[model samples]
Structures are given as structure tokens and as C-alpha cells.
Target: MNITSFLIYCIIITFTPGPTNIAILSTVHNFGAKKAMEYTYGATIAFGLLLVISTLLNTILMTIIPKILIVMQIIGSFYMFYLAYQIYKMDTSKPTVNQSGTFKSGFLMQFLNPKVVLFTMTVIPSFIMPHYIAMPTVTLSVIAITLIGFLAFITWVLFGTIFKEFLQKHKKAVNVMMALFLAYAAIEIWM
Candidate 1:
């Protein structure tokens, strides 16, 4: 496998402004980096698990029930919408304490996110050569991807943290924006 190609793939997957990153940003702005990092940690684990599952079941998925992927997609989108609502309703005035285990929110969100699933199905396969690549190598690749994903999310969360000084003044606007973002993600799933 070409290292550059894999690196490029990781960069794209990690940096994209998807639901996971959006949630982290919102959480950071409303709660703070400490809470947001929890989400990132959870999300990273979820990401690694998804990759491993996909790699192990690649043949099964590639052959049988490829279409059932749509189900995962729909479920994921709905979850995103639910999370968006939570973000929209967050009480920015009171910084929320991290009640969910350090990474519960981030972990579950990333684990269940359809967007991430679709991305994994689409991109991960390209890097993996089923014939040449051994399972151990694929597992390592997944781990690398997960680490990159964690860092990318951290960057977005930090962006929110930096913007908090300005965003705090306009909490209502941010809520509306979060609501709109959720709606857009849901609509995309249907399309």
C-alpha cells in the first residue's frame, strides 16, 4: 500500500466537517474542551471498532446485504438529528458538567453515525487489498485511521473553544444553526 495514498485518505476522513466534528464543536462551545475531549475519545474508539468490523466482514458485506447498508444510514441520520436537537437546546448559560462517562457521548455518536459508516464502506475498502493485505495489517490501518480521526475531532473542538468568546454572545443564533445542520444531515440521508 502506498503510504501517501493512505495518508491522504486519512486526512480527508479525519478533517471533514461531519456530525461527529460538529457535535464536538458544539459541546466545546457550550461545555468546554474538557467535556468535548470526552466525546472525541469515545468517537475514536467507535471509529476503530467500525473499521475492524467492516474489515472482518468485508466479504459478507460486499456480497450479502450490501443494500442493508441503507438501514444503517437511516438510523445514523436520525441519531444525528436527535443529537442536533440536544445541541440546539443546550443551556449555554450554565456550562454543563460531563455527566456521561468520559467519552460516552462521542463514542456512541461516532459508533452509530451513518455518515461515518458510509464513509468507511466507501473509503476503507480502497486502501485495503483483500488479496495482499493481511488481517493484522488492516487492523493496524484501522487503528491509525482512528487515531487520525481523534486528532481531527480535537482540532474542530478546539476551533469551537476558540470561537466561544464570540459565539457566547449569540447563543440563540448558534442553536438555530445547529438545528439547521441536523435537518440538513437528515435530509441528505433520504436523498
Candidate 2:
């Protein structure tokens, strides 16, 4: 495997704005850095779990992947729309950490996020399976990828923390913008 290319793909995919990242940013903007961190931890755990699942399931019948992808895409898209609606209506005036920023929410979101779902499904097969067939090597690869994902989540949290004041100043506008981004991502999965 081209380590450079693999790393690039992992970083770019995890770091990019998507449903989970936007939610994390919105969580920080509204609730606080602590809430966002909690969400990040959940997301990171789910991410690693997904990687492991993909690795184990890679040997299954390739013919069923298309069907599985379709189901995931539909579920993920609907979930994104639901999240977008939640963000759009967020009352930033009364700031309170709720279920939205909880670890469980973040963990569940990963399973319903198409960007994350697709990334986990493809990354293992493309990068690790191609070069490293040993179980230990594959386990290490998953850990490294999970770490990269955690770093990406932390970066988003820090960004929200750093710009918390500015983001809160225009909280309503920011939420709407983030909502639209999530909606756009949901639509983009098909094309």
C-alpha cells in the first residue's frame, strides 16, 4: 500500500465536514467543548467498530454489497435530514447540553452517516486487505485509522472552541448553514 495515499484518504475523509462533524461543531457552538468532546469519543468508538466490522465482513459475498450499500444510503440520508432539521431549529438562546451531544448520539450517528459508513466499508478493503493479510497487522491498521479519525474529530471540536464566541454570535445563521450543509451531503450521496 502507498502509505502516503492511504493516510491522505483517511485524513481527508474523516476531516471533511459531514453530518457528524457538523453536529459536533454545532454541539460545541451551543452546548460547549465538553459536550462536543463527548460526542467525538462516541463517534470515534463507532468508527473503530465499523472498521472492524468491515474487515470481518469483507470476505462475505460481494454480490450482496450493492444491496447493503443501498439500504445504508437510504437510512443514512434520512438520518441526515432529521439531524438537519434538529440543527435548524436549535434554540441557541437557552444553551443546555442534551441528548444531541451525548456519546450515544454520536455513536449512533456513525452507523447512520453515509459518509462515515461508506468510508469504513471501503477503506479497510482498499487499504488494509490489499497489503496486510495478517490479523495483527490488520488490527494495528484499524487502530491507526481510528486514531486518525479521533484526531479529526478533536480538530473540529477545537475549531468550534476557538471560534465559539463568533459562532455563538451568529448562532442562528450558523445553524441554518450547517443544516444546509448536512442536507447537501445527504443529497450528494446519490450523485
Candidate 3:
């Protein structure tokens, strides 16, 4: 694996504005950094697990990915739509109406998110597997990749935290914009 290329790919894909990051941002904006951290923990665990799964089942995934992708696409898109609805109606003034920012939600979101699913499936094969076949090396790579993903998740939370005041000032607009971003993510999965 070309280290630079792999790092670049991981950073771009993980740090990009996708459903998970947007969800984290919305969670931080509405709730707080603590709630967002809870969500981030779940997301990070799921991300690492997905990477491990991809490593263990790389060939099987390659054969079945098209079919799996289709199923995940439908499921993920619907979930995004649901999240969009939740965010749109989110009122920070009211107590937590739903548990969208909970650890469970974050964990499950990774499984249902097509972008995450695809990245986890592809990253191992594309970057780690080719260069290193040793178990230790592969495991380390998985850990490193997972760390990269965790950083990305945390960055979104920090971004929301740093701008929480401004976001809250225009809560309605921010929520609508975040909601629209998620809905757009849902729609983009098909295209």
C-alpha cells in the first residue's frame, strides 16, 4: 500500500460530510458535546468492527458486495430519510424527544449507512491487504484506520461544539439545512 495514498483516501472518505458526520453535528448542536461523544463512541466501535469484518471476509464481501450494496442502499436511504425527519423537527428547547443521539443509534447507523458500509468494505482490500498479509500488520492497519475514523467523528463533534452558540442562534435554519443535507445523502445513494 502506498502510505500517502491510503492516508489520503481514508481521510477524504471518513472526514467527508456524510450522514454520520451530519448526525453528529446535529446531535452536538441540539444536545451538547457529551451527547455527541456518546454517539461518537458508538460510531467508532461500529467502524472498527466493520473494518475487522472486511478484513476477515474480504473475498466473500467482494463476491457478494453488489447484492449487499443494494440491500444496504435501500435500508440506509430509508434510515437517512428518517434521520432527516428527526433532525428537521428537533427542538433543543424541549427535552430529548427521541434517542437519536444515543449510543445505540450511532452504532446502528454505521451498519445501515451505505457510505460507511462501502468504505469499510473497500478500504481493507484497497489499502491494507495488498501490502501486508501478516496478521499483526493487518491488525495494526485496522486499528490505525479505525483511529482515523474516530478522529473524523470527533472532529464533527468539535465543529458543532465550537459553533454551538451560533447554530443555536439560528436553530430552525441550521436544523433545516442539516436535515436537507441528510435527505440529500439519502437521495445520492441511488445516483
lDDT of each: 0.76, 0.91, 0.93
Tens-place lDDT digits, model 2, residues 66-130:
89889989999998889899889877788565666899999999999988888998999998898
**lDDT per residue, candidate 3, 1-191, as tens digits?**
68999999999999999999999999998889998999999999999999999999999878888999999999999999999998898765666644558898899999999999999999889888887899999999999999999999999999999999999899999999999999999999999
**How do the candidates rank by lDDT, highest first?**
3, 2, 1
The Cα RMSD of model 1 versus the native structure comes to: 2.3
TM per candidate: 0.87, 0.96, 0.96
How many backbone overlaps does candidate 1 show? Answer: 1
* Residue 55 CA displacement from its true place in model 2, Å: 0.5
State the weakest 10-residue window (summed lDDT) of model 3.
Answer: 91-100
Superposition TM-score, candidate 3 onto the true structure: 0.96
Q: What is the lDDT of residue 35 in candidate 2?
A: 87
The list of candidate 2 runs beyond 4 A from truth reads none
